[model samples]
Target: MDLTLAQEAGGSSLLSLLPFLIILLLFVPLFLNGRKQRRQMQETQAMQSALEDGDVVITTSGLRGTIVDASYEDTIDLEIADGVVTTWLRVAIREKVAPDTTSEDDSADSSGSTGTSESKPTIH
Candidate 1:
């Protein structure tokens, strides 16, 4: 029953490695998720640093504004409303808001052809 004892030893070896394999499986996804998050953060930082005047953006807190000035080292002037400019940290800017791509005719058509037009005031 020397053969039986050898078979039992091999089974035990496999069982001993089971816990290590489970732990490895658990850590792999966490490692990959962290790497992905770090890469995204880097991309966000790059976007923030490259911001310029007139670029509309949204903040982390859901405030939408236009970039009035980006000359400061760590802060930016965000005009949230006409004559209502606010200063914010550059890092607070979440993402640049894309301009509406529809043409004026398409927009007018969608609005049911309102004869009146309202011009938005600039922050200056």
Candidate 2:
């Protein structure tokens, strides 16, 4: 008997695996993407649940406000402006907004240079 049978057997096995390997490569990225999306959603939910009063946040609708009350199970009270409190679902919150530290420093510097009429107005 010739040893050609063994050589042909190995080649056929590799050829059979090609389609499976291609499928695996195709699905790996999708699996990783789904897992990443799930992790991000979990982080968002955790941040929303950890919300506290006085934390500034922005809503999905692009509304920025300070958290007035977060003790409610499903609702939160937000103050968008002075004396403008509104109740919204906790899930509606998009993310926490960091306070602008640079703006405060810029405002102070701009305030001192206010003698010129061309000086821009400083916002509190």
Q: Per-model C-alpha lDDT, please?
A: 0.91, 0.91
C-alpha TM-score for every candidate: 0.82, 0.76
Q: lDDT for model 1, please.
A: 0.91
What CA root-mean-square deviation does each model show from the true structure?
Answer: 5.2, 3.9
Cα displacement (angstroms), candidate 2, residue 13, comes to 1.9
Tens digits of lDDT, candidate 2, 1-124: 4589989999999999999999999999999999999999999999999999999999999998999999999999999999999999999999997768646877877787667565567754
lDDT of 1 by residue, 17-117 (tens): 99999999999999999999999999999999999999989999999998999999999999998889999999999999777733564686678666877
- Mind sharing the TM-score for model 2? 0.76
Candidate 2 at 79: error in angstroms?
A: 0.8
Off by over 4 Å in 2: 1-8, 100-124
TM-score of 1: 0.82
